[model samples]
Target: MSRPDLFKGIVSVAGGIMLPIDQTLLPLKEKAILIYHGSNDDVIEISKSIQDYNKLKNIGTKNMELKIVKNANHFLSSQTFKDEYLYEWLEKNI
Candidate 1:
């Protein structure tokens, strides 16, 4: 089956998906960037988030954090809509 093209518009947007990481996140280095991804996520691979974290870290972002929910799916099955990690991040950042 062919992949439904979801990236066409993404390419048009500067700092959108599949674009250069530095271009996308460099401007937000001063901001606290908290990324959340499920380790067992099938919709979006966890490596993508890790790669983003690594790139941001390499760029000297000190307030960045990546929380990988173990054995969780895309929506983090068995967890509340606002999970603990999210709550903690919000409390710290906000």
Candidate 2:
């Protein structure tokens, strides 16, 4: 997100925004953002994903989607499911 001009949309999987993001640029950035997190992720807690989502929303992300894969872990064990959703989301956003 450092260079919003380059990316049309952002897809974050098992990732979290640890540092504070400037709201000035974010509020004007209406690009689609997709966040996918595994519920049983041991590496990064799902709560972090949720918090990240909330942060994006609070900062004014218009077209954002958050998906939590059930029974999945940090590795995203269900590749099939992830691929399906990812394919769909990318097609729709990109």
Candidate 3:
């Protein structure tokens, strides 16, 4: 979000922001976002992405999507949505 001009859309998988959701003060409500997280991720808790997604929605973000993958891990060893959905999202957003 620091360099919004360079990014037209965002796709984050098992990723998170350093700051708290309520503390985010940037104008990110309109940025097209695709957030994905594995339910069984051991590296980063899924709550980070969940909370951030909810916070973004509550703050009036419109073009945002969240996918809480089941039976998956930090590296997404059990998920398969990337083959098609990811490309679809990228095609539509980017």
Candidate 4:
């Protein structure tokens, strides 16, 4: 599928400080990347996306949060949504 089509169902079900990494700038180098900090609007957008996805999938929000990483695309690039940062955020929020 096309790149955009592949991420059509993407969503973010939690909120927190996002240290989104820049994958396009990876391998050949590394950098500390962050985006959408303290942005309630962005967080809400993410939450809506998640909610829409869940509804489409016939799922319920038994346990969900409202937040997201910008420029990370779906799959949340390794550089953009690194495990360490994600876990830390999840630990604090969830």
In the order shown, the candidates' Cα RMSDs to the true structure are: 9.4, 2.4, 2.5, 13.9
In terms of lDDT, model 2 sits at: 0.79
Model 2, span 1-94: residue lDDT tens: 4566777787888888876868545643478888888888999999999998888888777898898888889987456354777888889988
Per-prediction TM-score to the true structure, in the order listed: 0.67, 0.84, 0.82, 0.26
Name the top TM-score candidate. 2
Candidate 1, 9-72: lDDT as tens digits? 1101001135575555455556676666777777777877777777767878788767676777
Query: Which pairs of residues clash in candidate 4, taking residues 3 or more apart in a chain or in different chains?
Result: 13-65, 14-65, 14-66, 14-67, 21-79, 21-80
Compared with the true structure, all predictions reach lDDT values of 0.58, 0.79, 0.80, 0.35
Per-residue lDDT, model 1, residue 43, is: 77
- What value of lDDT does candidate 3 attain over all alpha carbons? 0.80
For candidate 3, lDDT tens digit of each residue in 13-46?
8988677555343567768999889899989999
Task: Give lDDT tens digits, candidate 4, residues 1-94.
Answer: 1133222122233333233223431221111112222223432445545444344234322333334555543344454354476566555543
How much does candidate 1 score in TM-score?
Answer: 0.67
| Top-down TM-score ranking | 2, 3, 1, 4
Would you list the clashing residue pairs of candidate 1?
A: none
Per-residue lDDT of 9 in model 2: 84
In terms of TM-score, which candidate is stronger, 1 or 3? 3
- Number of the candidate with higher lDDT, 2 or 4: 2
